[model samples]
Target: MSQSQKKIHYAWVVLIGLIVMVGAAKGGIMTTGGLFLTSITEDLGIGMGSLTLYFSIASIVTMISLPIAGKLIAKYNIRMLLVVAVILEAGSFAMFGFMNSVWGWYLFAIPMAMGSVIVTQLAGPVLINNWFKKHRGLAMGIMVAAGGLLGAFLQPAAGNLIASEGWRNTYFILGLGVMAVVIPVVLLTIRMTPQQKGLQPYGMDEVKHNETIQVEKTANSGVTVAIAKKSSAFYFLIIFFLFDTSIAAFNQHVAPYAVGLGYDIKFAGNAMGSWSVGVVIGALFFGFLSDKIGVKNTAISAMFTGLVPVGILIIEPENPVMFVIATGLYGFVVASLGTLGPLLTTALFGNKEFSRIYGLAIMGLAVAGIVAIPTYGYMFEITGSYTNVLYAIFIMLIMNVGAILLAFKGKKKLEKAGLWN
Candidate 1:
């Protein structure tokens, strides 16, 4: 076949491989962490507040490492960087089986956070930006949906494993499993971009001739972090992400909260599993909706839906079914943030310095991790209930809605200034 008529582009294949690698690595750890929290606390005879402090430390490490990771991704080949990332992430997880003291978690959390930053947070968006010029939002949505799908399956499986094998073995098995799956996949299929394979993005051919000509002229005109930072839209976008993520921190404590309310571990796990199911559905739906209704509207709708679960938790639902329904609704909003967050950024600011800008923006998420989870734990430690945390989440939800509205208003200012096309 002639060069232009070659059969396979290979970049799409790489994209699929990344989806699986990221999904398994992230789902196996993040979604499963809460399931193990109760078991580990019981076995180790540690307070939940203290055990949760390890997560806070991890978030602090992640914040410190992000700028360095950003520099590495820009400077190095993606394959080597991802390989190191998976090893750090999975290896740290497996080593958790050996920890008998809180200090062990504090130390291991550093590497785990480092690996997670690369594989879970940075890899997907950077790869999607490199691979697909058109339908980029759809691609990002699918990637995040892949992670939720894995979580939907793996979370329940993790709960079952914890029930059967104990938490230590559970962590060992999952960590090793993620490593076994991700290592070969990254080495075999992950690539930096379509250009590295000498092929164009999959949909480039469908552009109208006039649009095709414009691609070359504007290829270098993508937005940079410097320009993005100068806009008010960027600041409001950060605020939007911060509040959205603070609400999501509730997932880290959902099982514990249920168990604290007199439910069995199995029931708590099943409740969390239901929440994951909502995540799967919401990710796919809101991802598509963001494309149609616009990012600002989609974000506002998500934050608005966040109020449902807080209401249920605060009202202290007597019926188990009501509790499950309310938490499931919250899960849907949380998943929408996963799909919409990056897309909103891309919409507000083009993909010029996408990695750097996104890196900076997700620092808010890291900060939320630092504050929200441990604060929930500490609130429970002090009051013996999650009521205060729920109230705080409700307030953050309201503020998030206002923040997103301000983002759109800010975007108009940027547009008028010729900052965004």
Candidate 2:
């Protein structure tokens, strides 16, 4: 078949590239950080908090890099950027095998965060929008499933690698191995725009060739960024992001927590896999629930689900099976940041200035990571247990409930002011 008449469009090919690159970046490298923590801290005689401070450093770098990444993605070649991004991210992970001190993690976190903000955070959605006009949600769902599925497999494999080869070689293998796989995929199949392939987006067949969604017409009816920034609702949403993300950031500690409770690293790995499974199921469930009920209820429901896991951990994590199941439940809650964050944004302010408003509010995510991850670590270090940490998560879940409530009230104030068109 001719290029235009081919059975599958190049957009799908680009999506294949995205699945490989994102899954490797997220599933293979980033999400596995916790697996190495116990070994590193125990081997080096570093405090868990002191060693995991790298997470805070990475979050800081990510926060600083976010706006710059969005601009760069808009202006640069997506393929070249992704290839380079994987190197910075995975390269840092590989080099961790060479480090002898806490300073090594603190130092390498810079490049890792810079690469991560692009590869894992921004690329999938942006590329999907540029390629799939119809079935956009399905495209995103597919990409998310790739991450969860890959992580499910990789988590246990990573645990086994760490058990056999040690954390050092596991780091090197996972890091360099992923770079080896993802680099070529990005170079070969990814593109910034469908225009590069001389074709329209996949769904354009149903509409006039020249017609595009009237984004401007819809955008004009929502809360403006300037107005949103001034509203109480925006600040409430920021608080919600901070609280919710702090809860999510605990994923990085799951392996350590399991190990601390006398489970082996292999069990921790299996637990992390269950978490990945939860992420997959939770994303689907929240999306469907939101469509059925509303963003507000779905978000509130997310906070409540978090309570179940925390309750289990605090009461009794003695059963390995139950612990894994609880971790999976928390993983379901972890997905809310992705599945509900955007919906909450639109539900509050409409679409008038979504990108800008969300960009600003999501600073809370980075800020939360900077504080929460290390806090969990230090709490473990100081107390010799994660009981206190789990209790704090319980409180935060309650706080998130209040934040969600206040955010809707703030939305009401905007509508009452006649600012909502």
Residue-by-residue lDDT tens digits, candidate 1, 1-421: 3565466557568778877887898678877788888888989998888998888888898888888888898899888888899889999998999999978888999999999998988878877777777666667677777777787788778888899998889899999999899888888898887878787776676567888888866644546788778777778888877788888888889889888888877777777777877777787778777778877787788888888878988895557998888777777789877688888777777666777888888788888888878888989999998888889999999998888778778778877877654
Q: Report lDDT (CA) for all predictions.
A: 0.81, 0.85
| Model 1 misplaced regions, further than 4 Å | 1-11, 217-222
State residue 340's C-alpha deviation in candidate 1, in Å.
Answer: 1.4
Candidate 1, pairs of clashing residues: 223-352
For every candidate in turn, the CA RMSD to the true structure comes to: 2.2, 3.2
Q: In model 2, what lDDT does residue 264 have? A: 95
